[model samples]
Target chain A: MSPADPIQVHLVRECAQRTKYVIDLPEPLSLQAYQELADNLPGILSSVFLPSGDVLLQIKLLEKEGSITGSTNSATLHVLLTKEGHGRLLEHILQELRNQ
Target chain B: MIDIREKVQFVPHLDCGSLILGGEPHVIHCHYYNHFLQTSIEDADGIYPAEQVLVGTAQEIGHSQFRKLFQEKGIQDERERKSFVEVVYSLLGMGKVSLENVSAEGGEISTPYEHYAYTYAATFPPRPKGKRGVAYFSQGYLAGAIEAICDLPLGSMGSRQTACLTQGDPAVSWEFFRLREPLPLQPSVGEGRYQTASLPQPPHTRVPFQAIRDAVLGLPLGPDPETGLIEAFDVVLTRLPGNYYALISERHFQHMLSAIGPDVIPLVLDMLVESGHVCAFNTLGGIMCSAEWDAVVRPYLDNPADWLYGIVALMPALGWGIVEPLTYPSSHSWTVSLHNWYETTAIAALPNGHTLTYSPFAEGIMNGILALVYQAGIAEKRLTFDGELYGSLFRTGRTYQSTFHQSRLQGAPTDVVEGHVAR
Candidate 1:
């Protein structure tokens, strides 16, 4: 869960099963970053998610303000890890972000 | 002056609209008799009476006496002044000057020959490096030409027509159409036929010139975030004399697509298209379809995971080509036979192993599988694309089946005897 490899392949798969959105992170994300991503929800008009630890996650919006309004037509989310989810294995990271 | 006896008296009536001005030896009594006559009507609404409106009797009976008395008391109290300037020619002496015909109408004058020269000159193409014909002429030259014509002492307002012919037919005017890029010629082969409706011919009306000009003068203009747009262009529409109008603001144009919505947007798009105002449709990104597209596909388009699914459903609705016979070529790639040209949309996979698509019509099969893989990866707590197979493409959409089958026939070479190249 470093910035260099923020999004792991496992997270994308997990996101697809639990929710309609499948977001992959390329780098470790921060809580503040996740909030900022959520704020852009109106423009993206699509569902977005950020895995925070194993049980908590953040959401963002997609498909918002159109071309005329200068919106980029995208929604980006960042997920961060909590102390409990730290592990050499990605399973620990998944456990931290998942609600269960 | 005549004096009245103290014993003389007058009767007072409250309902009567009359006023007594004085109580001296001579009493001046004013009566609004017409007002009383009109007041009796049920629907008079407290307006002046009809009798009072007539000039002969009610006027004489109510206020004529006062006029006569005033005239008797005034004599020779005003004087007139001579204010006319006289002009004399050398040949004429002792000629009386009179105010013959004083008119209030103003006029305009023009120089047509000069305009004609400029226009005629413009008929010839410009030199390779210099500005166009009219533009090549210095501002001062144009100004001098204008001053010379308007300076004509004997010219009539129609002289302006002469100036127009002389200077040039206005090749460019405030009313010229403004567009950053040219429009598409015809709907792309599979693109839906945008319905067109006749808009009110742009009103041949003009706003007050000064008011419109003043609206932008010294005003603080800037991008407003609340409107979610940027300033882009401005124009003035002039269809009447002595009237100028601001037809547009660049800032407003920025958000026009979303603001106008589907119903009225097509009218403008039609105009732009017909006029060659938008040059190209370069990218498949952005929300190009009208709100109708959103309304019809809202349930599916909103989820990133269903991006491909949603797009497949909308293809037929959009009248764009459909994706059919989606065959997975490999674990990470899929092949789709499109009913129409596929340049309008495409999809790609992100470095994070999640699939991202930019198809305005439908998310391809490959992107859907990528979505599944990404979801599985998240659940497994590993950012991996290991199980993602591109070749196992799933076919969707009833429209795709027909389109796919049709494409097979249409794309086949006539001379092909078997499943080999025609050659």
Candidate 2:
């Protein structure tokens, strides 16, 4: 979470027909941080709020690339985010990084 | 929704009749149709057969337009198609149309009443008071468009304006329902005649103002100025050309007044009042002296109802409003309301959308006509504004109200006739 130990983010091509970006997180953050990310992701991705208080992410096709990689002491996992999903994930990461 | 800016270009179509500015040919001119068609429908008493024909024609036209737009645009995608329809509706001033649960079968479409052409048309002359949904043309247009867009069999698709502006609804809602059987074909009554034809032709031959002035001066005074005035007007009405009404359109008349400026309007109106009195007295006197006076006119004078219809029929040909009987709330008076007035229509058509100054010419004529028809003395004749659009003509024995709403679209310096008739 320090300035020197920044989260790694890179653009990558999934195939000849498609391209995406990958984000490698420094650590599996606290549950509270994850919760905050989930809450703010919708507003970051789509400005409109649904009746159920959920936001539908509207991302352009070009922004749909990449996956979010989270690692712990024992294991690593990757979650694919659409363009809008990528936006929400990045916003959450920036917020957590700023807090640290 | 596909951005229209990316998908289409709007160049003005060469043909004036085509409502579609650009895109492939699918001409639909709802505005023109709304103005003229509604005028006809109003004239025809808003008959069901006329309504049915309008609906049928609209649907046919909708089918052709939709077919062309869909085909030329290659709009097979559902979202794009919906967007296309909405854009088309918005462009045509049908309001921003939205479809829900739309499929090959049918859907619910909704639009704000503000965009409906009928919302504006309903306000036109002979404005409907407390009437049900009068957006007959819009209803048909939607139905026809949907049937074509969905490729529904003719008459299988039915659309109704569930909510209408005329009914005080904020938005017009239409439910598209499938009919078990095709709609029964009704004999087509040709499009009703447009009121544009009824517009007064400009007076090519002018009547010299001096001649009228001299005629007024030379009118022989009888027992009193009132009696002599009536005799003079009767002579003018009888000997004047059939197109004497055309003189009201004389530019020289208006130009002369304009040259005199607004100061002369009152003086001119005072002259009109005297002329009105003269015309009324003449009419009554002529009827009294007629060969059939004892048999026909006398009975009507004795019983107001007997002669009312004859007077009503004669008034419109003389460029007046339709007269309907109104029950007199008081025992002492008889009352009738004039509907679909020609004067307000003419005035409303002037100066484009703005109002014109009030002219006492029509009012005076109405007063004169009412006084004679009711067999009331000049002193007993009275005219009063009911609302900006309506006026009531009252005589001592009977009352007549004009249903025509005065043209609010025109500008006037001051009201020519105000307050109750001066005692």
- Point to the candidate with the largest DockQ: 1
Off by over 4 Å in 2: A1-100, B5-36, B42-48, B121-131, B184-423
Candidate 1 residues lying further than 4 Å off, grouped into runs, are A1-4, A8-23, A26-100, B1-283, B286-309, B312-423
**Per-residue error (Å), model 2, residue B131:** 4.3
TM-score of 2: 0.33
Q: After superposition, how far is residue B264 of candidate 1 from its true place, in Å?
A: 34
Local error of candidate 2 at B120, Å? Answer: 3.7
* DockQ of candidate 1, scored on C-alphas against the true complex (2 decimals): 0.04
Number of the top candidate by lDDT? 2
Name the TM-score of candidate 1: 0.18
Cα RMSD to the true fold for all candidates: 33.5, 30.6
Model 2 lDDT per residue over B203-312, tens place = 22222222222222222212111111111111212111111121222222343355657675555454434343433333433333221222222223333433333333
Candidate 2: TM-score of chain A is: 0.39
Tens digits of lDDT, candidate 1, B1-423? 322211112211111111111110111100111111112221222332211112111111112222222233331221100011111100011112221211112222222212212323323333232222221111111222121222211111111111221233433211111123422111111111111111111112221212212221212122222221111111001000000000111111123444555464444333322111111110011111212112222223333323333333332222223333244222233344443322111011111211111121122222333333332222123232222321121222111110112222232311011111112
TM-score of each: 0.18, 0.33
